[model samples]
Target: MNNEEKYKKNIHHIHDKSYKDLYSKREVALDLFKNISNANWSKDLKAEDLTLVNNTYITADYEEREADIVYKANINNSEVVFYILLEFQSSVDYTMPLRLLFYMCEIIKEYAVNAKHKKYDKNVKIPAIVPIVLYNGEQVWDVPNQFRKMIYNEELFGNNILNFEYDIFDISNDEKLNKDALIDLKNVTAAIFLLDQKMDAIEFLERIKVIALYFNSLSDAEIKAIKKWIKNTVVDPLAESAIKILEADKREVELMVARNAFILDEMRENAKKEGREEGIEEGRKEGRKEGRKEGIEKSKLEVVRNSINNGLNDDIICKIANVSLDLVKKIRQECEKN
Candidate 1:
């Protein structure tokens, strides 16, 4: 499709990979459940208590499906599995409860096979599973958490119908679990949650600065992983040139944050300077010879072009340059050709 369409798809993929990578860390996973989950038992959990369950199993349809973040933990002397499904769609998925049910079934099937359990055996006892959906979408999540809600005449069926509810943490829309709550936890996952939210460049850089303070408790490897996640998820997709600026730093997390801030500030200044100079020249030609409207249009075009060259996306360019979406797309096409 078009660049915009590709960018949107790429963003979803990047978000998936980035979150999976982050939660791959035992400490990050531990922090996520501890800080985010409403379950009171999570407060006493430790990194050593959680074990990552890595398995690739075939679905009922014979398609290979790789499990994302499944963790096995013991709580109150009982085995429990936490299956975390990371969702980053811009809109809500109506079939989320059904999807989670299918995934949970797969997980349980795998567990049953591994445990050598027989159906309806006298000595068989299945471990409890706590399915959780972590959604970071912009839209409000209005979907029912209970699987029975998807079934018609569920109230009539009552106890006869199989009903189970998954815990959902709608990070963006949930008022009780917003960025402020995450920041209060002072963990790497909290910083990640904040950075993942939608914000402008200046605010994002400021957030990077605030996020650096939370890294003091992280190990060297954890710090490295967080930096790489930030680069891959945020910088590479939006401001490509910022990666070069970040690469110039060989110090610690604070220095990396400083470099990111510096990069955005420098890019902003350069865009302003280039837009002004180009606007003046264009205005000299168009304003005197033609009209004031032509000069203004030329000025906005210069800003849009400069923004695009600096690796800013169309949305940001449109806002900063005070130009129409059509104008920005047209200028982007012209720039790509040259």
Candidate 2:
């Protein structure tokens, strides 16, 4: 795929309300801490300090902002708070550190504004403010996809040792994690990395299906919705895997989905949720809202074209896109017209 098409595939979440509950849930921090490397998260504030209260806040800031998920966690202890700010970049961000620095400084000024720093040394009494960059783009991350140089470099050459100030996790390419870690993390980890990398959609889908089957009891239409997203994402590279599992037991998936009445409950709840968000946001941004609806449809067609290229089953693409189930029946008509 070209750069433009690939960009949309990896980073469309900022515009999609379909993910409202995923990041907003209190469990997101836990999942990211568990799956992402070198992250040790605690619900108990396991530090040598305060009681923990998990919190979240998000903003469109679409008009002008550097983050999609802007939040603060109240890690209470000794009247000292750990202030954190977060940003999720589906594409390479050249100005990320500067943006993070800007936000971090605001937290400091905020501390001073509240008179919380009174009678305390401005140099010592301030709480720690952390800014994190969760990079999920497809580049090496040494530089932005558009630019080719480091923005600034303050050389600290002392005793023949060099110290670079930037700290980043260039988790692109195949080094993200092994299949064992993916399976151990179950669905959430699978979703995070699968979406991050240009992994085969079919393989991820089949894995998600099995995970869905295990928790087939746990996944509601949400898994099905995620499947729809997986299908919308790309051609089913693991189509054979899904078919092998399905053909092995015709009634297995049917029974599993049925046993979990949770899907139906979720469907109803989702309908209400979708209506509320769509009504408010969609009404305000009709052009973008309709553009997305149309874009997903077109992206689905692109995936079908990829399936035909890969020699996979083209029968399910339309059904999976969920734009119109009737599109499946009309595939021959659509395919032949061109």
Candidate 3:
């Protein structure tokens, strides 16, 4: 696989594991919710009351896409569902609002089906849904956050149109995160997002230290899991090697030496690969051009032979077939000999 595809796969794996293992916990999920929603709703919520629901939703066509997390919680004495969409793509998806809308619809539809089987009241209302997008992409998300904002003639529809806006926690821009106030798990999550961005091995090691400090409360297994995740997802060979080495014990100087060596090796390999690909592409283009030119020349020769058989003179055949007089005379001699 190409480097970009490998990076994307690693990101997906890390996101899947982190959200399932850590963020699915009530305390961690609640902290993340509070940070994204900017609401003081945690005091009212008991950890036991928050339930993590299955986030895999199938569309009408039976195609499935897994959401990061879906939490069922009681907020303001009413049932509310939080749909957390973890976006780890390098580029911003402009259709995110529509995509979230479809997911919400599917969730509501499933809830309705279950309610029917339970024989709930016909007048029962659907729970409020809070769509949250946690994006750690390289590019800033510039798309509109609301479903209605995506419509071209949204203003013309006025109040009759349906619209919902999702909350976004853009981790690419550090301004969005309150680094000081975040809990340990949330801080670790932020550190993971920051690690996704481009950074040298030394810088990565420093970030790892910050994550390790916050990870002190967790079990050794948990720390090991995070380290393994770092090793897998990091694109830089030096960074990956450093994580593997640093996991056993924090050795900064050794990590730096490994990183420097990795950088030189990586540069050489990348240059060689790019040169080979360019050369191959150029060769293919030239081959196709030559083949086409030869085919056209062959076709002209056949036309010249046919003209000679049709009793056309050499001068006329040369003009008609767009060939030189000497070439037409050579063809005439070959035809006469045959």
Top candidate when judged by lDDT against the true structure: 1
RMSD of each: 4.7, 14.9, 18.5
Candidate 1 residue-wise lDDT at 74: 70
lDDT of 1 by residue, 175-199 (tens): 7767678667767677677766656
Stretches of candidate 3 exceeding 4 Å from the true structure? 1-22, 25-27, 35-37, 58-67, 75-88, 117-123, 178-186, 213-225, 235-338
User: Residue-wise lDDT of candidate 3 within 107-161, one digit each (tens)?
Assistant: 8887888767444556677776777777655467787988999888999998888
lDDT of each: 0.66, 0.46, 0.59
Native-vs-model 3 lDDT? 0.59
**By lDDT: ranked, best first:** 1, 3, 2
The collision pairs in model 2 are 202-237, 202-238, 215-218
Candidate 1 lDDT for residue 226: 65
Kindly indicate the candidate among 1 and 2 with the higher lDDT. 1
Task: Report the C-alpha lDDT of model 2 over 187-257, residue by residue, as the tens digit.
Answer: 56455454444443344444544554553332444344444444443343443334334334545754533
